[model samples]
Every structure is written in structure tokens, then in C-alpha cells.
Target: MRNNIAEMEFLYSQESIATQFSRDKFHQFLQEDMIFPLKGVRKKYSKNEIIIPEGEVTNEIYFIESGNVAATKDGENVINFYAENEIIGLTNLLLDSHSEYAFQVISNELFVTKYDKESIIEKVINTQEGYFYHYVHMQNQVSQMIEKEQLLRLPSEQRISLALLILGTKFGEETNDQDLIGFPKSISKGMIGQYTNLNPNTITNVLQKLQEEEIIYPARRAFYVDIFKLEIKLDQVLKK
Candidate 1:
């Protein structure tokens, strides 16, 4: 028994080291091969913290290192949620226009890498990879806008499911058990309702239905939705 346990420990150690090495190599490739050097001032923010207030003229662009942020047009309504590896506040930085939305940290462990627009433009944005990144980001925003419009027309349950799926895709971890995953942090029902323009009671009813169907499992304030099952249900709802 002792020998078996030692073998298991060794295997775990090997796996951990291999994973770390792969991550290191990937980051190194990004910096050297791709010539994409990510240089910024790292910042930490708490939950519900406001990073950029609406109508504020700012020259800083932020890259999310981890955690999630909600972009709100009104103080109470969430227009979009940004997750890890996403960039925000670029429009104000690139153009002279002021921000039309407020950006608030929605996750407790929000880690952001901030860059001064002037410095970035002078140093990075002028480079080839920088231009590519900028173009890709613009395309992504355009697609997101299109998605938001489509979501507005979806039924509340489907909208909520799609929202959760987006969050899971952007910031969730895959599990071995029934392939369950969702946001790493708990999101409030009120926030979800605000994002989907649904009432809390309606959201609750939908959640209960999902739970009954075994499509989702609740964890604290968040739900670990089974992606395959949810997609199937969404398809069924859309067809009907």
C-alpha cells in the first residue's frame, strides 16, 4: 500500500512539472517567437469595485489577467461581462471619445494588467503583432455586439443559459464528473437578472427547472451547468 501511494505521488509530481513547463514554454513563445511582449502595470481589484466610471475620459487600456468584469451602460444594468485574457477600455484609449459604459469588477480576485495608451501606441501598437492584436480585438467586439442583439430576442431562459455558457466558455474549468463547469466565482442572481433583463423570481424559476432536469447544479450563488445538456435544451426551446 505504501509503495502504491508513493508511485501515485510521483506521478502527480511529474504531471505538475510537465504542466508548468508547458505553460512557461507557451509564454516564452508568445514573447520571443510571436514578438508579443505583454508589458503593463498589474492591478488587483475587489468584487463590485468600479474600474472605469461611465463618461470618464481615460487613456489607459486594461488586459484582464483573471476574474470577471461587468460593463454597464446604466449603473444597474450589465451590458457585457469580460473575463480572462480579454481587453477593455480600448475605445476611449484609441479614440478621443469618452466611455459610454461603466466597468466594474464582478469577481473577487480581479487581476488586471493596465497600460498607458500613449506608451502602448508608441511602443507596442506600432509593431506588427500589436496591429494584429488590435484588429482581432475590434473584430471580437463587433461579433459580441451582434451576439448581444441576438440575445435580446431570445427567451429569458434561453438567454440565461446562453449567458452562462458564454461565461463558462470564457472562464470556467472542465470537470470529469458529468462534464460540469461554470464561472470560477459565484455570480449573484440579481446580477444575472440585470444582465438578462429578467426578474429575480423568473430567474429563480428557470434555475429550478434547469436543476430539476439535471441540466445544472448549484454551487453557492453560481450554477455548474452541463454544457451538452444545456445546449440540447436550448435547441429544443428554440425549435418550439
Candidate 2:
């Protein structure tokens, strides 16, 4: 299937080329190539829309604007996500190949941007300026990778807490009722397992214990952490 740029937006843009090259002569070069990808922007997809299959030869790239999309090796195993302000299909663009993971929408409001390889290689990468542009862009990726590695090294429980805490930190705010309220999101046992070494049954038990004592709220695939109580508990756990 063919895809265009408007269909995606950056889900995890550690650094945007636009913002990064704003003051340089590189803006025009990047702009021309960007226009080449969006020759046709398709309507957005609802959740579960299969944007790209795991192993297909495609020249398209996407950028997520809103919502979230997760990539997986099998349909069942999630690899990563394109949340907001990040590029999708980047692996393919850089490697001149296809994805080994399946991408599906996880949020209802996701939007994206798409582009082609020829434009990228020619208009964006062939020139001296193009070389510099890709250099700065790739450097940020190294940093993002390191951050993810540091995160993955933490225990599963900590990883879950960290993801939630990060999500909460940006979207969450303190309440006078002694709770931090942010995006009303959910966490599931299986997801916790993927992020850490926890098993489903153990995840269930820990979640239940937390919920029973009002430490968290586990609802099916969605779970909530009580900030005030959680912080106190985390403090004690960290000390140990």
C-alpha cells in the first residue's frame, strides 16, 4: 500500500530537523525533500489501522502528530511506539529497507507525515549541507538510545513506574486532594512483563497488592498509580 507524510507526525522526536535547522541554510533543502513525500496525504486511521507490515519493501516514512502507535516483531510482541513529535519508518529510511516490526495505532487521535527515499537521499543528503543535517539528526538518536538503555536496565516494576512517572511528569499535575492527575491512562500486566522480567501472575499479584492497599488501581489492561502514597512507598523502596 502507498502512504504519504500527512498521515504521520513525530511520536518521539528527540530532535526535529525543522527546529534544529531553523537558523541555517539547510531549511530550504529539508523543505524541498519534505514536499516530495507528501505528494498525497491520506486520511487518518482509527485505532488498529495497520500502517505498515513487519517485512515489506516500502519507500514511505511517517511522522506521528497525535495519539500513539506501537511496533512489534510479531503482532503480539511490541517493539516500541511512535507517540508524538517523532518519526516512524526511520529505520527504513536510514537503512534503505523495510521494517521487521508490525505497526498499529494505539490511540484514536494519531496523525502523521510521510516521505520518500529518493528525495531524502538526493535533496536532503547529497549536498554538503545535507551531510551536516543528517549528522546532527543522527547524534540525537544516539542520545535517545542511551536513555532507553539506562531505562531498560531498571527492574520491570521500576520501568513501569518510570514510564508512568515520565508520562505523568509532562502531562500530570498535583492536586490539593493529594494525588497527581495527568492523562487518565492505563498499564497492563503483560506490558509490565515486556518492559521488565516480571511474569504475568506475579504482575497480577503485585498490582492486586498495590490496589488492595490503595497504592494503585489496576483495571484490566489499564492501571493507575496513586502519587502521594506511591512516592512514600518508592522512597522506602529506594532506600533499600
lDDT of each: 0.72, 0.57
Clashes of 2: 23
Query: Where is the poorest 10-residue window by lDDT in model 1?
Result: 21-30
Q: How displaced is residue 60 in candidate 1, in Å?
A: 0.3
List the lowest-lDDT window of 10 residues for candidate 2.
Answer: 1-10
lDDT of 1 by residue, 91-157 (tens): 4446455888999987777998787777656534445434434444454688789987888789888
Best-performing candidate as measured by lDDT: 1
For all candidates, the clash counts are: 0, 23
lDDT of 2 by residue, 171-212 (tens): 343555557453334223464455444577866666676678
TM-score of each: 0.78, 0.65
As for candidate 1, its clashing pairs are: none
